[model samples]
Target: MSNRLKTGLILLTIAFLLGCILVQMFTQTLKSEITTLPDGYHNVLIRVPTTFEFCGEQVPLYDEEVKESFDKELYINVFRHSSTSLIIKRSEKFFPIIEQILREEEVPEDMKYIAVIESGLENVRSFAGADGYWQFMEETAKEFDLEISKEVDERFHIEKSTRAACKYLKRSYKKFGNWTLVAASYNRGMGGMNAALRNQNAISYYDVALNNETARYIYRALAFKEIMQHPEKYGFVIPKELRYPPVKYRKIPLDTTINDISALAVKYGMSYKTLKYHNPWLLMNKLTFDKKDLKNKKEYILLVPQNPPMPHSNVLAQESLQMQKMLDSILHEEDTVIDIQDVK
Candidate 1:
């Protein structure tokens, strides 16, 4: 090989090696830096306060079994950093809407935490066919006057479902005359809780022995409330901008059936995905009305994002510019020192 070619090859190989070493050092340095504990942090010993309450009723934290159950929920949630962080973040966005409904219905404000446990503030369907943030079964949702059909399921609509939940909770409160039992009744059906109370000859939820899942229901809700009320104490540290903000939207009424939700979205100057993000209640591409619905003049609400995500073209352009800037910085860093010995 010519001398010039040999020299170029040597520099190229040395530069590649230097880049690898520098990248590794940078990565290791970052790894060693103090960072948020994403997997939960705890000391070897932990103590929980003896007193706790759900709604206006007190938890039997003084009892050993109750303490054990409360501890399990509290520690498990604290250590589940990522999942709990999402709950912490989403509550800020959704809790205000729910709180308002609770006030209107005269339901205790703490009842809003039930949604956190039901679906983690998400529009999710359960394996058992329960849907929405409130996780209402089809029959229960319909009973509470929430529309659930193939084209639409209002159980997925945050505001609508919360109102439905409040309706159900108010009915439950009337039956039990205690908000605590009403909260439990939401998990184990009102009938089931009544049966447990009757069978055990106990008047309150604490005195009745129930299945594990139902038993843990109130405790989990309580755990989430504690964390939400005091997130810093539980180790969640969300920054102002990093926190998910409440969504603002325009709710357009739909008296007539929409042949296709996607086409409707285009009319509103948004993509179908953006439409779905704002209106999760829309389960299908089309919204059709039968004679019964048309005659009844059924009304559905379609939410359009007020601040739709940056248009697709803009997002791509911004991403490209960011990539170019990063590439330029890396090239500049390499330009300043191609000598391998200088890196050391």
Candidate 2:
């Protein structure tokens, strides 16, 4: 055989060998990227029956419009995994207090989910000067009987803000004569919702065309209700033990000025940060004596931590339990429950 022919054949052989090796490497890497699930990883979908009642009007979920809106929220929330998961996690920490307040106020139980959509259950301050889980502006907060001032903004107080929200919802219901409209009015002001109703000549919140946020508001609430009610259907697998536990506290009525909050916290066996964590409404490091209160004689309520849970105690506990279960099930290791002793 000629040397040229021999070289060409050898070169083709080398190229073929290189291509095969590269293909094998790529396949192995892809396989590793797709993590293998252990036995029992797949969970059965749990379906919970849901029916809507708005302003004493029973709305059937099977109705095409209702189903469409419900489906829209369900699909969106299910696919938006991160936000939904966070909402689920936070609900454990905040929902009990919110639910209790809602019950006391005689507000609809479903309305608790409104806070989830409003601030994801965080004490967040909006750029537009709205603050708290319920997102109350200064004037609005004061109008709803929430104290908003330089030293204190009770809008950050979960209980106070929720009560304010209930009042607002009640007022909205009175104006619109519909719970759906009341919910929508939370996004679009009562005046705006009413104006939209008049302009479109539609009485129903579902029928009315609205601005972008208002349009999606009710659907978001419905979606949250569906996903939260049936987490497994939406691919969420949070164990019962993985849910956040409620924090305990005692209320202290303060009639006098606190010169040093740090000292006050230390006196109560807590750090300054801990005091602030529980009482986010306390905006200042030092509490000033209100001269007007002395003449008028009003008392300030301070939430003193009796035995507050450790920071991120609920989240850490949940994550640890989940990881332990996964580790045991996947690795064929013995299931061991780690005792999370209280840190606070």
Candidate 3:
């Protein structure tokens, strides 16, 4: 090659390298703050907002360390597309019920997101024996009026579990008066949180030196709230109809002992599996009731689904809606007795 040609090639390569360096520098500068939404839709990157809050409590985003921690959390969730997408979809079905309960109890709407972080809004039993969407243990569940006998475990009951959670949140708020700390207290017990505050000599949750799980708790809840409210911005593109719609069920008043739940299921024109799916609070194969029990508890709410439940689904939810609409017989009247052999 000629010397002149070699020099020209080197100059071109240098220009290209400089351009790449400048681009990388510009992108790094933009990572901390988004002055405007970036162009593009699918597979685009996003940064955490400069200003953030939880239930109206301001995050100290101005501090570099705090901002970086916020950045880490947002990235962890926003990039976890599949799981986060499931959460976005599940929220549509569950949040309506949770929000209504929170509103009725005068709790902040943000508390609904805690359920998302707790069990992904599902009836999950934790390794520690914490069960349901709110993750309450046996004592705690009973302490909050959740019936957890051999026949019933209200921890798996959605509305009842949420009401119990609201009761816990209210008690926490009475002690801390800060919703964020109250959120942290859900993971770090109320006493643990109080001790941390005293030991660290800090008034705010941000100031406390906490264990990894407790420290990450509020941030995870905030991240869930942020992505859920602004799904598109976080690159979650679930359609409105594609999100899981709220479950529908017919409420049956059960006053007598259910000697055999399988028979009870058949009497309702539902499979045994379908019966338990809807009435997760029904803990046993047989529910024994004494006549005396009815004096104080006049009736129990048996949630028999109008159609089978679609847990963690959008397409199945739509299909279930169609099933509910089909012309069908009321296979047995409410008073019909199920055969004992069906139970056997």
lDDT of each: 0.85, 0.81, 0.86
What is candidate 3's local distance difference test score? 0.86
Tell me how far the alpha carbon of residue 111 in candidate 2 is from the true structure, in angstroms, after superposition. 0.9
Tell how far residue 268 is off in model 2, in angstroms: 0.9
Give all TM-scores, in the order shown.
0.77, 0.75, 0.76
Model 3 per-residue lDDT tens digits across residues 28-51:
889845555555546647677878
Residue pairs clashing, model 1: none
Error of 1 at 206 (Å): 1.3
Better of 2 and 3 by lDDT: 3
The 10-residue segment with the lowest total lDDT in model 2: 40-49
**What is the lDDT ranking, best to worst?**
3, 1, 2
Q: Write the residue-wise lDDT of candidate 2 on 178-233 in tens digits.
A: 78888889888989999999999999887887887888888788778777877877
Which scores higher on TM-score, 2 or 3? 3
Superposed on all Cα atoms, model 3 deviates from the true structure by an RMSD in Å of 12.4
What tens-digit string does per-residue lDDT give for candidate 1 at 27-112?
88888775534464643233566787788788888789888888899899888889998988888789889999889888899998
Q: Give the TM-score (vs. native) of candidate 2.
A: 0.75
Deviating ranges (above 4 Å) for candidate 2: 1-66, 309-344
Candidate 1 — which residues are off by over 4 angstroms?
Answer: 1-46, 313-344
lDDT: the better of candidates 1 and 2: 1
Candidate whose lDDT is highest: 3
